[model samples]
Target chain A: MNTSKTQKHRADLLVSCVHDRAPDLIPALEAEVKRRGLEGEVKVVEAGCRGFCSMGPVLLIQPDGTFYVNVQPADVPEMVEETLVKGRVVERMTYQEPSSHACALYEDISFYSKQHRIVLRNCGMLNPASVEEYIAVGGYEAVGKALFDMTPEGVIEEVKKAGLRGRGGAGFAAARKWETGRKAEGDIKYVLANGDEGDPNCFMDRALMEADPHSILEGMIIGAYAMDAHQGYIYIPYEHTLSVKTMRNAIESARAYGLIGEDILGSGFDFEVEVRVGAHSFVGGESTALMHAIEGTVSEPRPKHIHTTEVGLWGKPTCLNNVKTWNLVPEIIGKGAEWFASIGTEKSTGTQVFSLAGKINNVGLAEVPMGTTIRELIFDVGGGIPNGREFKAIQIGGPSGGAVPASLLDMPMDYETLEEAGSMMGTGGVVVLDDRSCVIDVARYFLDFLKDQSCGKCSSCREGIRYMLEMLTNITEGKGKMSDLEVLERMGKSVKISSMCGLGKSVPNPVLSTLRHFRDEYVAHIEDHKCPAGVCKALIEHYINDQCNGCGLCLRKCPQDAITGEKKELHTIDAEKCIQCGVCFDVCRFDAVGVR
Target chain B: MPKLKSLDELKKLREQLQGDIKARTDSSTTITVGMGTCGIAAGARETMHAILAELESRGMDTHVTTVGCIGMCSKEPLVDIQQGDEPRVTYGNVNTEMVPRMIEEHLVQGNMVDEWVVGRVEG
Candidate 1:
């Protein structure tokens, strides 16, 4: 029996979600741990996002798996005195299910139990700032295997066998791009990790980047070896300060450990990676546009008639993968292609991490198998819609991605299925809409966001989005002509074909897809001159109902000061003073604010 | 944090680092203390200090943690010791003087102080 053990610390307190809204908790935990002279027995580690954003700032005691939710500095001493000193569980601090009213262990939580974790495996498990913590959990082992045990051709062949596709919206075959870059004629080739996550509702890449930057680094290292590229760049948006900082720290740690730089792990393969801050615009997600940005130009998409795999960045052959794509590399190499292929669907293998938001309970990052149904993700994983509201539609992908109504809740999600439903699996940013959501207004909202971020390089995209926004606005404000609908469809087709890049091409997806599935919402807004969901401020009117019961709550909370009420009398809204901000509708505890 | 030279060395380093993050890889027997307001008021804090001091003096590393109130306010300063796969035993009204004997008999000697035991929680 080889019993060489060095279990020095009795309890390792791994704090999840420090980068989120939670305040500084470790310092207080550390100070209390020391006061008891149990420093040798207790250790506090600031881990990365656990993907459980709803119960953020949670503290997990490893070995025991005692997870404490909503941990504050004030709770540290009692926790230390109880759990750290005496090894008793604090029931009040543990995670309690919203509906079940039952406490659960970290792994027992349905949000985590129902899903499979790959990219997030190392996220909340280690100190991302430390290379040793990464290694302790089998971090760089794949890089070592690729560097010494596998040949360049072998690496690419394994990836090809795995059937991994680019996760950055395109679903382009990842290994084929590596093959192109490998065979491309150039002495100076490059591999780029696209960290410019521009999707508004998505933070999957940021979570991985800030939490497990080493995973991306290791993946890029394997890619560089496969492509025989000497240098690479991780292009992050400047706004994700934590991602930039953690990635830089990971690279530095990798360098100091000799896992990066010349002759890594005693192998002759040489590679280095540097972070290139890029424009955070949606257009920058395009490979060519990102290449241009890396070359110190404006992030504008150019025609991809000539593939960037042949010639990119400074006229050199370049291989670019999303930060998520890079993140999956080391796993495929270490765990074998067959293991990865065994998961998800046959074609779209492996898991995808989705950032859940918008009118949904338990909004956070979830990594589910490729073919998970929309129902499972919403009800089982996301804890269904908030306030017991009926889920109206579950929007997959992002702004450029289309909306899938509740009628197709059981549709299994994959690249082919989502695209067939008129939505591309664009970066897995899921936004669930309740019955209160108007699909027309939803389309208008996305088009509005895209309109702001559109590079304006292509007239079809620029003018198409402008025209769509105008028509959408007209329909919402009860000014739409029936002919406007036909023109919208015709113009949408023209825009789809004439657009130069994805940003332009997918600009019409929102309008076209919503029209395909939910035409009645648009008809109601146009034919009946009624905002069915009471969303369009121009069409809807608000008034206090008889159920108000003299509640002064809305009066005090109303931003516009349009509500008037005595101490014990029903409130009345000054219609002229009401700006239709909907604050009254949201704040009314008695559901007294009526909208039409 | 020495620069690793080869894959074999990296493997060796992993085994060593695995020990560093032991709580991450494996679960072990644990010791629990109730630090509820009632427990603390009944001298649970001093009891914890004694437990830690006794273990520290003996150069022992144990998995000691805390819990909230267990609804036994009269039986405050409750301390429970659990070995692997064994039913957890709770001692009631524990004082600082009882810590050394508890650690010696329950933890080191693999025997419970049955006379002072108030409850048994079977896994």
Candidate 2:
């Protein structure tokens, strides 16, 4: 009601309207703007996630590029009165350096300053619902060039020259797959974008899809032109409700704008895209299983005697690429192969978007060029391990990927380098672990995940994973003999060699990599029946230390009520009644609880 | 919302849209007011309006905009001004009356208000 004369102008306030905490903050911002009678001069526009989840409820002031974090509804009035009406920055809301107490701009923050944004270039910068915003940032230009100026062979050639590999895990050459589909003997060819991101702690693909859906769509359209495919499908997991909605909207808008559907851009290249949502199945991310799911069949992978590029979806030549892989097509087509090749390593060209999560200070998506060392990714970009804990290991890739020890922190993170270090670059999920994490328990956790996700098609995968899980369970339970380690090694190798699909083949990665690196932890568990990190419940016990001031906080928080003491006296845990839940260890604020 | 017919049309559209973006995002001189909660509480909105009114009165082409807090909440109502390739000068606790002097000295005469300047961002 208090509309000012200047309120009709384009966005004056750009609130980060992400799914996390923006919903509650938006109304407060609007109400304050209205109450202050500055509505006419200040227009609020809701944008996507700004990648700084730890400091969410973030706001970015335009024109001057001032960034605010940890904003609350209560601070709205003064923000409007001081900043909006008086043209003054409310210093209390600005991001300050933790140690120096100096203010930092968004570009100057180390969390955003050190990273290169290729796949995530558009994230936090544009409104995903608006197609014009996508186009203004050069979204569909690559598809136009591919359709009008370049031939199909030229497009494929450009991709090959860029040295772009599949980002889905295997690092297969994307252009080679496109060439296969182009040359495959089939009248009806298909191109698929695999959005079924199954890796735990990885949300890079989901972020790209939800934030910049058009980029993926544009990439797929170009791929369709290169592979001579008439139809394309974007297979996203159903749990990704925002991604599905944004992608479906993006496809519709593109169709309505003549970027897709029949006679795209009047270039006579008729290609259409459909959004398919499937239930989350870990094994369903496999190419063959994905294609089978698209065909309305059971989501299970078959033997790959023939490559999917030659024999795929509905028994036709289907060119399937990961969401991130397809997203790169537009950039390569727009900037040329040489420009893309100049960014990363010689073999692995371009930047990799990593979901940096677990035990790190900054937990979000980071895009860095290939050949970036694990030390830089973890310490520099990820803000190092949280709470001053010593870095122990990083579980690179996902459940199927291997763990890299602290000694290998300097190793460059590329497909071949990670593989040579006994780990595969599985979808770029970098889960850092600290000294408190038990390596044996980490291996057992991943093995348990794989055992559940395996398709159970082959005996090597089904039986081998079962046996491995049993041994790991025994080791964690402090019931394992020394000879079981040999059995684990033999069965792990057999699974890797005899499994029918990638899921089965890579299931032993966590076990084998942990064995190869942290065998001492396993020996400690087997021989001395001791969990070094105090993680295994059966091998460890909790006790109150001398530091306890008898705060009674731990006693109240204990679910089993095993701890008892006076109000101001050190508490003792009844070892028989204690379930070793570690609640006391976690709740004790005085560093009094000890586990050994 | 007609479909772009050809490559030339697409390029032309991009140029037009880019012109609009550049008008707002790029300029020879940029004046930014921090409008985050801290900035607003400290009277940054008033400072921004003053700058906007001054620019409007002078009919200056200099781009004026608002950014979120830059983590100096202790010094509320921060203003940053940049001319050409020169370093951006950050002014702390800026008030409404400082707008005209900033525009006249920094924008017109190319002389920075050094006493008010708190920090400098390297170009």
Candidate 3:
């Protein structure tokens, strides 16, 4: 009566999110598993980031999909007994929804359920360092498929069908670049993977580079195969040491497996790849500037009279792609182009990995389909703004990219839609802004950033951005004329049109978009000399209201001894001494601190 | 780490390694054999090897492991099978020859062998 035995699988206790906080659990889990005599039955895999950064040191038991958050070495024994050995979930270890107070599994969690991970598919599933594990999860098969199964033109056609675009915010068609490189007359063409991410809060590229490095290599190999290019360079900022290290390791592993070197998969295709570290700059992610850096020159953009796809990297046809774009290549090839195109919108196909930062409740990485509205990305996937504050704006794209106001929350996040809204999907970095965030101040922040980063190749970028920054600064300090707004818009537009590279072209997006959408906020500052958000120091004054119960917390926190009050009575802020620091506003439990 | 020569070779390797990483995926069935000295002396090691090879040939992905004896010396080589949310079924006096049918009836068919199964425990 006995039936056939099933192919035996191993149970893996994945110590997910193996970053700075993982060393303790990683070592303890391995040693404890061995000591408990469960090594054969259970495997301790140190996985990459699960994208839920705040709730990490997470543990996931595979074959059962039981996820435990905030696990520590001290809890390892009980976890090993109650979950690993006993074959059940430790209910207390699961993640609880902040509002609902309800516990849910990883798949059912709102944060994860809303996300459709394509680029991040392998990020937390396996040990990134192990090529065997990568292969086990269907890695590097794309190279075989690309080189053996499809011709170069066939591959390009497939990508065109997929409608893959540049994810570094430019939104250029990836297949168009590859086709140009393939058709261009060159014997020494190159494929470049741009990991030199420069957005203020964007780490999606770095995360992809660090977490699943083999995927990057796999994608690059496929790119090289498609473009008829042999040499490749992964240009990462020097500061991303972990990403650099993992990429190098992944390259070596792929090379050893003959996935990267000559005659890959026994086909006649010969390709090799290496890592290139450059001086970190916001402009470094731009295709032209990245090529200049790779050529051992100062990292600055060159005019695109002749495209890089035709002549680049020492006068050879070169194709450069963002790390996220390169990461998606393998997935597209492995799963057909039609499958990828089916996910996102018609024009913008495939999913985008958006790094949710700034004032959001869930400050993590989310890969959602392209057609997902900004509302879904911010509220459904990103868990909305923190502390029940009203959403004022979201700075999407990057420093050079524009901010969308709460009015456009329903705007679908595709290249065309975001661009039409005066924003670029700058590598999918979404910085949420609450009511407290000043649009003028936010624009000033980006202008200040661009002033330092712009290469000065175009006078419009150098002078235009500097003047834009000064005007925004003056406006924030309650010193703007109505005439200044017109000049600012004209200059922002000139910089957008005149700049040679991506840096200057899109540099003034923040100011222009804010002026376009939140013009009343600027008028509030210019005419009334008041910062509605109470941020500009020169325009606002702080005082304690009658609601103050004299907690004395603000008195202790005030650096200038501006606050003085009795322990049980309403406190007062000395107007002469108050520097408008707003420390009292942050510290007071009661709604006592008022800005006027 | 010799380079794979062709697509077929890579495909073969993928198919082979898929089994190795199955435990790392969403495989819910687990097969545990008693590997204590008494069990090993009763040819449990051979039975375990037979089960592994059989599973590979059958392309069935499940978790296979070994545990210490529970003092049932006479009923040596006790093999326990547990599927997802299913009660663990223990088969007594299991040998190499009994593995194929145990896999068929218990794992593939989802039924306990009437005469062979000695005990059961909560999943």
Candidate 4:
């Protein structure tokens, strides 16, 4: 055996090293160590993409849960000199504030104090690229326990007892699907990981897959074992590079370790995993359309006659769950049903991961126990709205989800509650809105996205979405009739009822939700022919206030030279030439710009 | 390839690990470098390397290891130090240049570097 290998094996420090997004720092740091003669004392390792994207570069100190932030190239010396040399700490750079002093712990930072990470537990802990690191942290031990210790029926019972419903918006009980798949009359059953997360501002599933690929793999393997499925496929988006690479490496590593492909853990069950990447069409995220795309056909949905559990993917008993749902399986099994059931609300066990973005002080991924109030997510975890802006509305669940007005901030964030609030918990993308955001414009943006993404297989989806888009466009453009509201509601219902897939079924969410919560915004646009938030260009005009010294910056920067004013005087916009471009508004730094 | 049949067998594995780690006990200084994915992405690798190198160069018996992210990615290259009942100090935005002084002043002399410590957590 190699002496270096022996030394490595003997190293007493249990280090799970991860550099959030900039993995290139590993080799460079390793080089710095060797150049300075600190080679054998430290072991350098590379890992996965931690889910926190907004904070770009971060590192976590373990065992005692010390966290540090905003680390740059220059601070390394002070860190090493103070902490490592004399066995004392350099308090200034710590993640946790000196308790007896003014600084705060990482948890006290309002951004993280409210989060309850479950699906994302290993994201920033273990190296995503290493199978061994995953194993050391009890990654595949669940598969071992499930395959040998428990019967398939026992596994299903445990999951049922755990109350782990699907996290991918549907909230279907995961164990029941397995039970149904197991009961279906078929020689071959299939397990599929639905990685088609095409929602706007939704990155939780992708982040989970990218950060902890093996956990997902282990979960899928366990699921396959429970359902007697021999093959699994991960239908990921073609554009998701990090998740694809991580998942592929994980699958290969599992195969090599005899954890997959043939008689895993010496149990007489075999499973193989495959990957299928799809294009940018949002319709492909729908189950039937995704299956059609997988079957070498154009992505389109078929009516639900034979359930996927009964016959799917070229006429076989198939079971498909989203990436987040698959990611939760190992945790449920490893921690035991009761422990898993202990988290979150009674109806919604465990935590739900959300991509917290838009106008918030902290924009990143957050995992809070289910039934966490939107107020807590936005105010406490998101650090409130940026620039002290008043909280306006929060659009939950992407384009097919509804908007929650500030009045409902105390509403719990779960499938049933959000649905009652006119929003489905579709993938947990909460885009926090500030007072500056126009509710009508926000609805319009989601409508535009849905309109372009509709597969056009059903007449209601195609025609209805197109009509809704036209009406919303007309409303925003100050050309809508009062009767347009009636048309929009009628078309939205037709699309919801006659749609072939979830994509079409939920397409009217933004419009319906906005109408429910902020019908005033739509009325303002239609009746007054004005945008309340002054966001829609056709309804608003921009002008520099008299406070402007006519710096000439605004005049010169105007696209069409709309500003007509002499130097050292307030500028006036020529309404004829203005085009309401708002260039003059943006260029004035003296708080002279006003949009009306 | 066999399941742990009895408690005795599990106990043996524990004993083997204990014997392997006998030399390292009562480590005076515990320095943890954040190596979570976000931390790693944020240049944690460099911070970790510099910390270890500085420790070895100063001949300090500090135990340097990697840990997971505490979910603050805005500040990467995190370092946590615990020494002799002194409050645990955390350093953020760590890089190579800060390592030597951190090792010399903080680890060796037990003098806290006020400029480098960004936070502290209670035991």
Instruction: Calculate DockQ per candidate and list them.
Output: 0.30, 0.21, 0.26, 0.05
Q: What is the docking quality class of candidate 4?
A: incorrect
Over the stretch A1-596, how does candidate 3's per-residue lDDT look in tens digits? 11222334446676766567756888888887788776765778777778887678887766556778888888888877656554445678888775675553577788898889998998787787888878877788887888878998998999899999988777899999898899999778999999988998888888888789988888888888888889999998899999999999999888887888888888989998999998999987788889999999998888889999998999899999988888888888889999999999999898999998888888889999998998999888888888888899899998878989999888898988888999988788888899988889988998898899988888989999889899999998888999999999888888888878878888889999999999999999999999998899999999888988888999999999998988989888898998999999998888899998
lDDT of 2 by residue, A1-596 (tens): 11122212323466664476656677888888888786756666566666766677778765546677888877888877766665566788987543335453577677788899888887777778878768766779898999989999999999999999999999999999899889999899999999999988888888888888998999999999998898999999899999899999999888877898888878999998898988788899999999988988889999888988889999999999999999999999999999999998999999998888888888888899999999998887787877678899999989889999999999999999999888888899988889889887888888888888988989999989888989999999999999999999998999999998899989999999999999999999999999988899999999998899998998899999999999888789999999998989888889899988
Error of 4 at A202 (Å): 1.3
In order, candidate lDDTs are: 0.86, 0.84, 0.84, 0.74
lDDT of 3 at A24: 81
Rank by lDDT, descending?
A: 1, 3, 2, 4
Winner by TM-score between candidate 2 and candidate 1 = 1
lDDT string, candidate 4, A346-443, tens digits: 87888888888898876789889989999998887777777666899999998999899999989998888899999988888989888878887888
| Best-fitting candidate, scored by DockQ | 1
| Tens-digit lDDT track of model 1 for A222-259 | 99999989999999989989999999999998999889
Tens digit per residue, CA lDDT, model 1, B17-96: 76567667754556777878888889987787788667656645465566778889999899988887889899999999
Native-contact recovery for every candidate?
0.50, 0.21, 0.46, 0.01
What TM-score results for chain B in every one of the models? Answer: 0.78, 0.77, 0.84, 0.75
User: What TM-score does candidate 1 get on C-alpha atoms?
Assistant: 0.89
- Winner on TM-score between 3 and 4 is 3
Off by over 4 Å in 1: A1-6, A20-23, A102-104, A564-570, B27-123
Report the lDDT of model 4 for residue B11: 35
Residue A189 CA displacement from its true place in model 4, Å:
0.7
